[model samples]
Target: MVLQDLGRRINAAVNDMTRSNNLDEKAFDDMIKEICAALLSADVNVRLVGTLRKSIKASVNFASLPAAVNKKRLIQKTVFDELVKLVDPHADSFRPKKGRSNVIMFVGLQGAGKTTTCTKLARHYQTRGFKTALVCADTFRAGAFDQLKQNATKAKIPYYGSLTQTDPAVVAAEGVAKFKKERFDIIIVDTSGRHRQEEELFTEMTQIQTAVTPDQTILVLDSTIGQSAEAQSSAFKATADFGAIIITKTDGHAAGGGAISAVAATNTPIIFLGTGEHMMDLERFEPRAFVQKLLGMGDVAGLVEHVQAITKDSAGAKETYKHIAEGIYTLRDFRENITSIMKMGPLSKLSGMIPGLSNMTQGLDDEDGSLKLRRMIYIFDSMTAAELDGDGKNFVEQPSRMVRIAHGSGTTVREVEDVLSQHRMMAGMAKRVGGQKKQMQRAQNMMKGGNKDQMAAMQKRMASMGGAGGMGGMGGMPGMPDMAKMMQMMGGGQGGGGMPNLGGMDLQSMMSQMSGLMGGMGGGGGGGGGGRGRGGR
Candidate 1:
C-alpha cells in the first residue's frame, strides 16, 4: 500500500475507536492492532513497529486516565506524536550560511537519482536568493556530465564539468575552486554511484570527500529499496561519514514507510524528500508536518510558505488583493487567481496542503488536475474584454452568451455556468469582508514589521477558525484579508454572515463548487473534451 492508503487506514482506525459508544480499553487495543497492521503492510521494520506499539500503549494507559479528561483528544494527540517520533531522528541537519561557499557533496547507490536531485536542490537555493551552482564529478558513469549539463542549462544555473578529466576527484576539486573563487553561496557537487557497496565506490567517495571537503555530505537513498535502506545508509555513513539524508522517489508506488523508518533507525536527519520528477518537487522534510500531512490533517504552514515564495513578485496578486479590499471581484480578477495557482506548482500537490481538499481530489492525478486548470484559463481567454471585466451578471441576463462562450472556449454551457457561479460566490465573499480592510491593513503591517506578539495573536485566531490547532499564519499581503478572516471564510463561519452558503452542499460538492474560488482549485470533469478545446485555441 502507498502512504495515502496507510494514512487512511490509520485514520479510520482512530476514528472508529473514538466514535465508539463504549470507548473502553478493548476498543483502544483494537485500534492499536489495526494501526500496527497497517504499518507492517507498509514495509516498516518489524522491530520498530513493535516499539511504536509499545510506546503508544504506555503513553495512553486508559485505566490511569481520570473520567473528567477528554479521552478522545488525548488518544489523537498520542497517535500523532508517536508517528512523528517514528520518523524524526531528533538530530539537526547542517545549515549553510549566506555570503560563503557551502560545499554539499552527494553520495548514493546507482540509480538513486543523484544527478537530477543536484539540479533540483541548486534551483531551490537559487530561488531563495542564494547564488548556487552545480559541479558534476561523476567521471565513472558515461554521459553523467552531459546529463548534469542538460539539467543545469534548463534550470539556468551555472555549472562546471570536464570532458577530458577522467579522475573524479580532480574534477570535483577544480569545480569547487572555481565556484568558491567566484563567491557562490551554495556549491553542490554530484558524484558517481555504483551498483552495490563495492570497494571502488567507497574509495572514490573518500577521494571526492577529501578533494572538496564539503561542509555537508548528503546520502541520497532510493525509497524503492524498502527495508534495506538501513543497511545501505549504514555502509555509506561508515565510509563517507555523511551528515544528512535525502530520500528520492517517494511519489512513486514504493512503500516509502519502510525506507523512512529504516533511515530514522540509523539516527540520521532527512533534510528533503524528492516528491516528484519535477525540479520543484523537493520538499523540506519536517517531522511533525510530514506526519500531519500523512494522516490527512493538512499542513497550512507549508501552504503559506509556498504561496509567499511564489507570489513575492506577482503584480496580479497585488491587484486582486486591492480589488477584493474594495468589495469588487470581476471575471478578470478570478482569471488572475487561477493563473497564479497554476504557477505555484502541481495542483495535486497543492490540494494536500488544504484540510478537506485532498480528499475531494483523491481520484484525480497531476495531469488531469493540470488540464482542468488550463481549461478554466481557456474559458477566461475566450471572453471579450467587456465580459472579462464585468461582474458576470450580463451572462445571466442573456443566457445565449453562455453558448457562444462555450463554443468559443471549447467547453460546454454547463462548465461556463459553473465558472460564473464560482465568480459570484467569490464576489459575494469579497463584498461581505470589505468592511475589515482596516483590520487587514493592521495585520499586514504587523507581519511586515515583524511583530511577533501581534502575529501570534492573529495566528491563534486563524487556528481557532480552522478548528485545526496548528494552522500556519498567513503573511497578510497587501490588500489581502487577515489570516483569521480568510480561515473564517474557508471554514464557512457565521461572523457577519460568512461566505455565501452553497445551498447546504456536502463536503465533496462544496469543494468542487468552490474550486475556482479557493486557492486550492483544480481537479474535476472536462478532461477528455477540454483537451480538444485547448488544442483548437
Candidate 2:
C-alpha cells in the first residue's frame, strides 16, 4: 500500500512507452526520465534513482537485450531488480554472537513505541526458545516502567524496574547483573525516549550502554518521518552503536521512500519493521521482498514463511505428525488449529504474502481484504465440531447449517457457503497430497527459494489443487490423533504465548494452576526476564 503511488507512476511510464509500436530513442529517454523524476518525488536519493535508471537503460538498450522480448516486461523486471538491490544491499545480517547474550538497547524519541517494540522483540526471541528478559531503564518517562510491565506481564517474561528510582544507569547495571546471574540467553534494555539533541539524556543512554555492554543497539524510528530521517539517524548514531534500525508504521500509506532509502544515506541495516501496534506485528526485514512490493511485484516466500511461523503449532503439523505416528489425533487438535490461525493475523494478510498475488489483489486495498477475511473467519467460528469434521455432503444434506452460521457471525449465507467450499477444497487437496513426499518437497523448495514469480505460480497451482478437512486429515495417518485439539489447547489461555503453564491447560489456567509456571513465565525464574531460553537465526 505504501508503494501504490510509486507503483502507479512506474506502471504509467512503462505503459506509455510499450503501448505503442513506435520505438524511437527519444521516447525511451522520456520514459526513463519520468521514472527518475517519480523516484525523486518519492524522496528517493537522486543518485540512487539515477543509478537504477542507468541500469534499466543498459538492460533495454538495443545492443544488449533480445528484440523479441516485450520491452515493457523487460523494463519492469529491470526496475524491480534495481529496487530490490538498493534495499537489500545494506540490510543487517548480524546475529547474536554464539554463546553470548546479545544485549540490544532500544533508543528513540518519545511516542515512538520504544517500550512496545522492546516487548515484541522479547516475544520474538521467546518464541524461538530464547530465555529473554527486559530492562526498564526509562526512568525519565512517567509510567514507562508500568507500560512495559503490563506487556511483560502479557508475554509472561521478566522485567527489572524500580518505581522509586530515577537512576537509569543503576537500573541498567542491576538488570544486566540479574540476567547474568540467572543465565538469560538475551537481555533487551529499553531506554527513555528523548529529544534528538538532548545531550544530557544521550549521556545517560551512553552510560546505560557502557554498564550493560549490549551486543546490538537498535534505534526505533517512526516511518512517518519521511526525508527527515537522515538527521534523526545521525543524531542517534552520534551517541550509540546504532547497530540496526526498526522502522515503525510501515503498514500505513505513507510514501516511506524516506525510510527505505535512508539506508542509502546512513548505511544502517533495518532489522525489523513495525507493521502494526500489536506485539506480533513486528516482522524481520526481508529486503528482497520489500523491494519487490515497492516495484509492484508479489513476495511469495515472505508470505509462506509468515504462515509457517504463525502456524507451526497448528493442528496436524509437526507435533500432530508425531502424535499421528503414535495414534493420538483427537477433536481437541482441530480447535487448536483454528485458534492458532486467528492469532497469526488475518487470512487476507496471509493471502498477500503469497507470491504472484499481484493480479489477485489488483483492485483491492488492505481494508477490503481484511474485511473479507474477517467475514470468512466468522463463518468458520460459528460451525460446530460435527460440521467442522463432517464431509461436504453433510453440509449439502443440510443447507440450514449455513443459515445458522451466517446469523451467528452476522454474515451472509453466501459467505458461510464460501467458507465451507474453501474447507472442502482444502480437505480434498490434503487427501491428494497425503503421503506424497515428492509433492511436499516441491512445495518446500518453492517456499525456500524466495523467488516471488516462481513461488506465486506454485501457490496458484497449489491453491487450485486444494487440501482437505482443515487439520483433521492427520487423523487418518498412522498413529496420529486429533491435532486440532492440541493446537487449540496450546493457543487458549490468558497472557498470550510467552509464559509457561501447568495443569496442562491454556496460558491463563497454567498461570492460575501452578506457581512454578508463573516463575518460569516472568524474568524471575531464569535471567530476571532477559534470560536466554533458546537461540537461533
Candidate 3:
C-alpha cells in the first residue's frame, strides 16, 4: 500500500502549506518534489512521473492566483486531478451484459496469479446472477487444472478442464462450447502462462484466443513487479488484444504505482484490483474513490455498495438496524451483526472504508484479526436467552453470570467477559447513534446531488458517536460532536449520554465493565434511542 501511503503524505504536505502565512513557489516546488519522490519510490515510470509533475505545475499557477482564492484547496485539487489523469486511461472496456454469452480470456505470466483470478472473476459474475463457468486452458504449469478446480469448487463455480488435453486451444474451445451449449452467459477461460514471455507460451495464448474469439481478454498483472509492470504490460499488449487489466496481489507490500501507471501507459483500463487471496477480494477499480480511500477520506458510497452486495432481503437488514438504532442490542443481535460483516469480506478491508478507521486498520494485514469477530459469535451463542437478550447489567453486577455463560458456551471466562465488554460498548453507541438518526435522515435526503450541507449534517452526527475528534471531510469514525444539552442530559457529564471513555479501554478490562452500558444493560438506566438510515430502511 505504498501508493496509499503516498496519498496520505501528499494530503499532509498540502495541509502543512496551508498552515503557513507565506504561500510561494518555493513551498509548491517542495511539495511537487516530494510527490515525485514518492511516485518514483512506488515504481512509477520516470517519464510518467515527469509528465505528472509538469502537468500539476502548469495547472497550479500559484503565482497568478487571486488573493481571495484558497491556495491550499486549489493546489490539493490540482494534485488529485493530475494523479487521477496519470492513472486513468479512460479507455472503453467490455462490460458483461445480461442474458448473453460473454466470454472472457485471461492472460498473464505463470506466477501472475492468472488461474486464481479466473475463479475470482467467475465468482464475481456468479454472485451477480450471471450463468458463469471457468475453463482452465493452463496446461504448462504443474497442477494448473487441479489448482483451478480447487478454487472453483470452494467458490461453488462450475468449471471445465481436461487432464488428458495437451493442446490449450482445444481445451478452451471445448470448455467454452460446453458452457455455451448449457446457455451459460459468462464463460471465463484461464489460459497457459510461462515463467517468461517465451514464444511457446505466446503461441499457446494466441491459439486459444483465436479459437474462442473472446468477447474480452483480461490481462492479470501482479502488482509486486513494481517498475517493470509497464514494460510487462506493453509486451503482453503487443501479443494479445487485452481489453482490460486486473492487478493482483495488491494487498502485498509491493510498490504498486508502477503497475497501475505502466498498464495505463498502454491505454488499457484497469477494471479490478485483487485485494486479497479470497474469491471475494476482487474489487472494481474506481480511481477517484481509490485515491480518496487511500488518503483516509471515507468512501461511504463504496462501503454501502459492499454491504449491499452481501445483504440478502430488506427484513434482515432492517432488523439489525433496529438493534443499532435502539441502543438495546442483545447477544443474539451481536452474532447476526458479526455474520453480516463477515459476508462483506475482510475486516481490515471493511474497517478501511470507515473514515478514521483506515489508519488504524492499515496495520491489520493478518487474517487472524478477522477471526476475532467469529470468536465473538461463538462466545455469544453460549449465553441463555435471558442472558443473550437482556440488558448487560446482570453479567456485570453478577460475576457468577459470566462463569455460568462461559461453562454453557465452552469458552474461558475471560473470553465471555471480552464479548460482554464489546457488546456493552456497541449498545452504548447505538443509543447515541439512534438519537442522531433524524439528522442522518435529513443529510441523506439532501445528499441526492446535494452540497456541503449534507456533509455538514453527517459530520455533526458522526462526532456524537464518541469518536476521538472531528473528522476531516473536514477527519472513525466510528461511522461526531454537538455537546451542550446532550452532555448535560447524562447527569452532569456522568449521565448515560456522557458514558465512560470506552474508546481506549482494553479488551480484557472492558469485558468486566459491561454494567456501564446505556439503556437497559448497565447500572445506569439506559435512555431511549432510535434511527432510520439505508440499513434501517
Choose the strongest candidate by TM-score.
1
TM-score preference between candidates 1 and 2, better one: 1
Candidate 3, residue 407: lDDT:
55
Q: Compared with the true structure, what per-residue lDDT tens digits does model 1 show for residues 323-388?
A: 765778789888876775677576567777667677766766667667766777877877888898
How much is the lDDT of residue 80 in candidate 2?
69
Tell me, by lDDT, which candidate is best: 1
Question: How high is each candidate's TM-score?
Answer: 0.83, 0.72, 0.75
State how far residue 169 of model 1 sits from its true place (Å).
Answer: 1.1
Query: Candidate 3 lDDT, tens digit per residue, 415-451?
Result: 6676677677777766665554444445445655557
RMSD of each: 7.1, 13.7, 10.8
Each model's lDDT comes to 0.77, 0.64, 0.70
Question: Model 2: runs farther than 4 Å from truth?
Answer: 15-20, 58-60, 63-74, 90-92, 97-99, 314-342, 346-348, 356-359, 362-384, 398-413, 438-537
Task: Output the lDDT of residue 466, model 2.
Answer: 39
TM-score of the candidate numbered 2?
0.72
